[model samples]
Target: MISSVERVRAAYARIAQVDRPEVWIGLRPQEDVEADAASVDARAASGERLPLAGTVFAVKGNIDVAGLPTTAGCPSYAYRPEADAPVVARLRAAGAVVLGTTNLDQFATGLVGTRSPYGAVRNALDPAYVSGGSSSGSAVAVALGIADFALGTDTAGSGRVPAAFNGIVGLKPTRGLVPVEGVVPACASLDCVTVFARTLPEAERALALMAAPSGRELPALEQRRPGPWRIAVPRPERLGELEEGWAEAFGSAAARLAEAGAELLEVDPTPFIEAAAMLYEGAFVAERYTAVGTFVDGHAGSADLDPTVAGIISRARDVPAHRFYADLERLSALRTRALTALGDTDALLLPTTPGHPTLADVEADPLGANARLGRFTNSTNLFDLAAVAVPAGEVNGLPFGVMVIGQAFTDERLVRIAGLLAAPPVRLVVVGAHLSGQPLNGQLLSLGGRLVRTTTTASAYRLYALETVPPKPGLVRAEEGGAAIEAEVWQLPPEGLGALVAALPRPMALGSVELADGSFVTGFLCEPAALDGAREITSYGGWRAALPSLAALPSPAALPSLVRTEGPGLSPPRT
Candidate 1:
């Protein structure tokens, strides 16, 4: 088993190997990490509970950490804080150690990660590629395994874009879910604290700890199998700036979901797109200026802020008071439109980044590029949704992620669903009463089972309605004349097989079952000669439907329901 401390150490080594991404101005001293590790070890020996227990993480420079300087990526505005921000305090109490502060678009102004004065954070996988920002450093740190997780702020796509580009998980919790007390404001109304991690489980654990612990009971986490998943896609007319290859990747991902039993529903994503436009194009850009205008003006002579960031923040100084009110009114109406568009879907899937841009690519059109980066992300906080970015696939080896946005407060449910959708694991085909929603399903569900694509085994096995204590289905491999049977493949952790096998009823056992793809898995295999006058239920493609429907026909109880179909078992087809 891999320990979190070992994971953190590997990440630190990777961060030390390369020149650190220009996204950070400094790092925690080596002596500090050593001391922290010692304390963690002592606690482990003493059996004291440590919530995070040696997990290493980073904070965006703008959020204060005791004894560290708060620069917000702008040196002129740097100030040492006497205490950790509230969010940091909570995480530290949970046993997470802060490694250092990361660089960002100065004052968290730009969406593109390149506007920082320290140095542009390069993509973790490919150096030439620009790391998405203003959460650039945090995303890179997690992507390169520098920390188990890191904290960043998402005013626009700062939290999400970087995760998409670097092949990591970025979670933007509902605004106000994690209080923003002590963090610098970058459009405070829409600003949200974000977390970046390599895996959904790790990210989700951290999210639970960081969320403001409330006494109110949250709904039980919902876990719907992959089939029946309904996703609302962007209206074809609203997709903008998607690169050629990216368009194909999105389509292919959707196709994969369909294969896994999901229903892809296309809805007009125009209202959300229209709301996204309001973030920067309306008065919200002025809010960015409001947060840091005085500093920019006071330090005009000494500040080395990116000229482009400075230019946009300066726009705040020119907005007429009345126009601000008018913009607010329009925004309210747009929010309603957004809610209607998102209704009736598990999540609204969108390209993490419409497209990727390079350092040189962004420098040429900083403003235009930054605006484009937020095309799909700007409305997240504006409309108030919790989202997680997962690595969907790749284009030319660079990562492309999909954002699963759900209604606010359903954050936990979203994470559970995201875990199910992660890359498929070892398949375990079940050919009997163990199907989902069946009595034996509790056994599989207890073992962290995830439904993989559901399908029937090739016609080469025999099924016998086994007469057992609870009445079960017996699937057995047969020679030349076996009929193809119905079954569903599920994924489970390799270590969890023992418990499942131990719970099997007598007569009906676990063995290899051949799937349509000629693959095999641990599934239902029956005893020999169990089939006598058993009525075949081969017409129904799956065990659940076939068995129940067969019960209704003639022998209902007398007619043993047996069919020549693939019997559930975990054995590769005889090739």
Candidate 2:
């Protein structure tokens, strides 16, 4: 595998020569990137770990990554920040090194990436095609694998449209799930930090790391599993400005969902669409002006900013305060209608972007093309929903993806579903608390799952003491015939198993192992080899009883609130 650092250096080498098309507004020094690479190498050699170790990533110009200037794609508006935004801080903590800040529509005002004065960020797949913006370069960076993932701000599809245009995964997390403290907001209430990654897993990994704690408790993982999920689809008449092949691909995808046992329900998305319009078409545009009004006013004569972007900001100055508040009220009402449309559904399915437009086409009709791209994305923050875009198929040699939208705080659920949608299904047996109704069982259920059987491992395994803080037992398959250990079988939906697997701690993994009934289930297998000289505890059965008792375990009140760091067995909420 190419280390993310190597990929960044490779991209830099290519970008250094005629960097115009990729459009980096805030390129980092080659020396800084090399130093980060050295750090990654040192950490790996020293046995220090990182979930995103050696991974290279980028952020849209609006986000504050320490040492990078916050330009929002306008040179006159640029300013160096003293600290990384919370999202960037989190990613750094997880071991991902920043590549550089990318180009975007000035002040993130345009959906098409061409509005930047630095240079238009071209589509990664083809220079002739437009990279959707205002987070265009962020999307292209990930699409071309220059970075493992890129951070973009989504206040009107700046985060999502570009991913679709570039053929990558765009994760527009639930608004507020990722904080916006350091972002140059296009619409403060609707602005969300989004992630772009080549794969759903990579995107989810980045989301988990960057998401801040919301302080609200999540519904137990098992409780989140709606028994039979309803997946909402827009009524055919409502699919707007769609490309030819997108309709076919979406229909085929829906059929696959039906075949896979989802209850596909057709819904009138007019209310949702109406709500989406509130973002830009209504007074919400005033929020955009509010985000950077002072700067725009101070630099009124700057030729560096895009004229269209400056015009939009200038127009916002005329809106009265009452109109902005009225828009907020209207948006609230629309949110209620939108939520009703998604009621009881596990996810609402739609095309990631209505269609892709070429650079020439976007340049010819900027505003019209931009509005067309937001057809599916404008309502996310307005309705407080979490969403992820997973690649589905292709059209005219360009990749197309499906957007899975779910209720807020259901980010993990969407990821699990996205993973299933992305990869082929696998059958595996689970043991211990992973079984239905068990403490850690929700992880499986959230992915649309069910119990296959209650079984046992083959008579060649010894369960032992593993160093989990809530110390757990690990089963080691032995060549010499050993005692049959108890376990359970699970029938997981094709994309339903990731949320749980992704939560496992270090030294634990999903492995092929025998069951008590002389069968195999993809169950929890431990690196008991890491438990050398540790106590053998197979006689007490599984971790539930063999491990320490919950009664004697420290009460929530007694224990210091240890942030559930990302890894296996931890499902800490993303902010």
Candidate 3:
């Protein structure tokens, strides 16, 4: 394995070789990145497990990273944060090192990556093509291998569109699952932290580390037991606006899914389209205004603001509060109707974007092209859904992608489906301390493990509360009496399996464990002798439920605050 310090050096070397200034707003000094890598290395040397120990990542400029100036793609609006965004902080704690902040559409107001004052981020595959935005640089950074994965914000299609254009995976998590505490809001209520990575597993891993504690009960995810899935697609007429060859490309992808046992059902897209239109055509625009209206209005005609962004915010000022409320009520009705229309379907499959636009194309019809890009995506967050965009194939030598979407909290299900559609990796089932938000979960994450879904083990094993310092679990196969115990299935890189197995403590060992659905996979198991003095807790069903004390641990988002005393000293623009 490459050391973290060497990985950081290689990333810097790649950046120097590419010399793409437009892809970054402000980068951390090389020495700083090396220093971070050294710290990670020291931790590893001391036997501390780091899930993302050698991982390099970049953050969208709108997200604060303590010492860096957050420009949000507008130089004049830059501000130095006293601490890292909750999402960034979580990633760092998981062993990922931040390279720097990448560029985006100014204030994250546009889908076209071209609206930034720092310069339009060009497509990683082709310079003439426009990098999809407002998360432009973050996607480009990952696609170009300058970073292993990058953080992006998705209010509309900012995250997915870029992943499509760059032939990568973009995981737009459910809103509030990943906190937006230190991120500059584009649409405060709709904004979500998104992950961009070359592989689906990598993106999913990042998503797991950043998930926040949701206070309310969320919808249950679609079952993971492999069988036939009913996937919904828009009617032919609804796809009529696709660019040349794109419709054909989409059809081929659907056909591939069918071959993989998916039943494609065409549905009316009216409700979805209406919900999408409501984002800009209805009072939702006021939310954008609510985020930055005061600042833009105070600086009216300043040269610092992008003209398109200024115009969009200016139009929101005239929308009366009553009108906003009316639209909100209308949206509520549409959302209910849309959910009803999608009844019981496993997932909705759609093109990530209607087409890939060129820099010249965006210049010719900026707003129109940008709006088209959001046709299938703008309604996702509005409808309270989760989506994962994966590269389907190429169309006319340009990258194209299909998005897998489901109701909110189905993020892991969507990611699992996406992995199945692409290339399935080795899966490992974890029972106790290795689950997300657990004390020892970092060990799995550092080894490139991603949570697939939380399910139960076959009713043939007994779970025991081991007498350990941090309280671990011991699972033993029982022939006569056993109960299905809650467990989380995770995808792990095959290369890391040996190391993971070798590092297991006394009671735990790698063995085949059957899932509730009778599917078997390599997982953690315990020798019967190890459970001699342990308390049998199979009645509790899962480790989490059995240990009430674990509930008091702070969530990933609520970890200790890190206060930085030094920054780039960029003055905040006067309003």
Q: Which candidate leads in lDDT? A: 3
**Model 3: worst 10 consecutive residues (lDDT sum):** 561-570
lDDT of 3 by residue, 1-575 (tens): 44688668767756764568889988889998999999999998899878888789999999999999988877777899999999999999988999999989989988889998789899876788988999999999987767889999999988899999988889998888999989999999899999998788788888998987975587665565665787888765686488888888888888888888887888777787778877887888888888888989988888878888888888987888898889889889988887887777878888998888889999998888888888889999899899999988878766789999988888787887777557555788888877765655654544445566779999989899887645678988898679999898877555335546655567778899999999998898987888887888888888888988433444433321111111232112111
Q: lDDT scores for all predictions?
A: 0.73, 0.73, 0.82
Task: Give the distance in Å from residue 425's predicted Cα in candidate 3 to where it truly belongs.
Answer: 7.7
lDDT of 2 by residue, 1-575 (tens): 23545544555644532244555767788888878877876676677777676577888999998888998888877789999999998898777888889889989898888998888887765677888888988888776546668999888877778887776788888777778898877888778899997667678889888877775566453354546567888855588658888888888777777776778888777776777777777777887788887788888878896888888887887888888788879888877877777766788888877788888888788778878888788888777788887777678766687888888888887776666466554566665545443434434433334344556777788877655544456778877746777676655535345545665566778888876555555778877557787677677666556646422332323322222335553334332
Q: What CA RMSD would you report for each candidate?
A: 16.1, 14.8, 15.6
The superposed Cα distance between candidate 3 and the true structure at residue 357, in angstroms, equals: 1.3
Model 3 residue 38 CA deviation (Å) reads 0.7
How do the residues 1-575 of candidate 1 rate in per-residue lDDT, one tens digit apiece?
A: 12344434544544544446575676877667657666676676687777677577899988998888998988878899999998888887777778889989889887778877788888876777788989889888776546668999998878899989987788998777887877999998888888998768777878778888643455453555465767777644468668768888877766766677767778677766777887878876888878999888776656477787787788778877887899778878887887677666787778877888888889888888877888889888887788888778778757788787887777776675565456644568887666654445444533445455567788887666655534566777768657777777776644335445554445666777788788777777766656665555544544675666544323222321111112342211121
- Candidate 1 wrongly placed segments (more than 4 Å): 1-9, 214-227, 235-237, 301-303, 424-575
Look at candidate 1 and tell me the lDDT of residue 302: 62
lDDT of 1 at 510: 72
